[model samples]
Target: MGIDACTSRPFRGSEAVARGEVSWGRLAGPAFRPLLTDVYVGSSAEVDTATWVRAVALWGRGAGVVAGPLAARAWEAECPWEERELIMPTSRRETSDEIDVRRDRLLPDEVCFRYGVAVTSPARTAFDLARRGPLVEAVAAVDAVAFRCGLTSAHLLAVAAAHPGARGSVQVRRVVALMDPRAESLMETRLRLVFILRGVPAPVPQYEVRVRDGGLRWLDLAWPRVPAGRRKLGLEYDGPEHRTITGQNRDLLRDADLDDQEWEILHIGAVQVFDERRADQLAARVMRRLNPDP
Candidate 1:
């Protein structure tokens, strides 16, 4: 028999078989992909993070709130969807390589719903992510989520105050101090953090420079103030998208405009922000420019 026509969402294998939608053999075939033990989605189903969240919710019979990175992604944060995380109130024997199940109870206000699955609220999601990973990465994750969810430093701090004894609360507080909602991308946040961690004065995120034609040009990061004869410094994170010919041409035009306005622009790439040695070098270069020899 052909696979079930309802391939848009996940369904139980037994139910598909019993409903005469798909045979047991067909269900076991490549036509369907297993999510949990019995949970399956059609092989062609466009399974995204939300799909996985819903599948796990079904597997657990809706017993837990989806938290951590998965929850951040569900809230539109630019987080990696490597694993699905579920916070359960009680322990369970079943476990899957695809899911990270944590046993913890959540306050009523901490839980919310997204894409029809229970998830931690933005504040709680920020709280969890801001406290879990490397300091720079944690701050970047929180920045993306905060910007997407319209959260401010105060919103994150309020959550931290409520969970004073929470693991990584100190990290969360530090993240709050560094998080900038104006950050437009993950790499941008990392670039900013590199300078901050290297002891270079923190450059403003998304700094705007007024152009010749009464238009405003925003730099990825900028220091508006500088000593006499030293142009204002602007730093840009040039991701892969900026490597294309058209993108390069556009950047040239923009850079020319900024140059005419006496703004010095430095373009940074992934290596400059990710590679530790290179990151230090990049920061050192910026320091020289910002603090030229007197």
Candidate 2:
């Protein structure tokens, strides 16, 4: 009867019409916003994680199981939100604008229920995304799920080992090998990968540094095993969050304190990550620091 039932949650248009709570004509009007083909949310409601999960329920129609990035999102793993991805073992069919449907089967233990919708387990979701494409993002996706789900590299390797001939299995192995639980952001993972792929010594993530004022600070990327008397190097990705005055002031203080403790800190932003030249220069700078001339 009220928008609360529909907008506050994901509801099928047909469900409301069949219950006589609303006329078919009313369901198609401005009062409701379409989430998928037959799914609608309250027009006034803000679409968020819960809404996305509910939309998955309506779109799935009890047949498909949520997979890929949507499953990762449901598990609270960090990833970009583009569209809802679903997989049904029933048949191979064309995908609709509402969601992506793949004709793939999951093992009995690979599916679980979350947000009132059937979804791939965290490990399964990580494996699925790792096999899906662009290696760097896939690696970041797996790292995120592992970090949040308390999964280890062994778990990811075990999952990869189970699917011998699966597509991207090799990439999955590579991603597992590079997975780091301490990585807290996609940019950090990407930057780390850049160093590895560039044949530079990989830095420790979330390394602890003792500040001059007795406070503890964590470095995003650090060469902590440098010689006892030699200074250590660190690289930090400064995203949009660091652009504000408060953030900048905090960073300045943190940098000064770390500098006093023999840390050679380098700061980069989103632009450096996207530009190949900038990324290469950063890698070279790190390498030079790691293996400085006599």
Q: Estimate each model's TM-score.
A: 0.93, 0.94
Residue-wise lDDT of candidate 2 within 1-294, one digit each (tens)?
Answer: 544434677788788888877777777788888878878887888888768876886777778788888788898888854658888878766568778877876888888999788898888888887886688888888878887898888877777777778888888877887889888877888888889878998788889887878899998888886755668888888988889999899999999999898888889877667788987987887777777467
List, residue by residue over 152-239, the lDDT tens digit for candidate 1: 9988888878877988888888898899999988888999999999999999999988899988889999998887789999998887
- RMSD in Å for candidate 2, one decimal? 1.8
Model 1: weakest 10-residue lDDT segment is: 1-10
Model 1: CA > 4 A from native: 1-6, 18-20
Q: What are the root-mean-square deviations of the candidates from the true structure over C-alphas?
A: 2.0, 1.8
Off by over 4 Å in 2: 1-6, 92-94, 227-229
For candidate 1, give the lDDT: 0.85
> What lDDT score belongs to each candidate, Candidate 1 first?
0.85, 0.81
Best by lDDT: 1
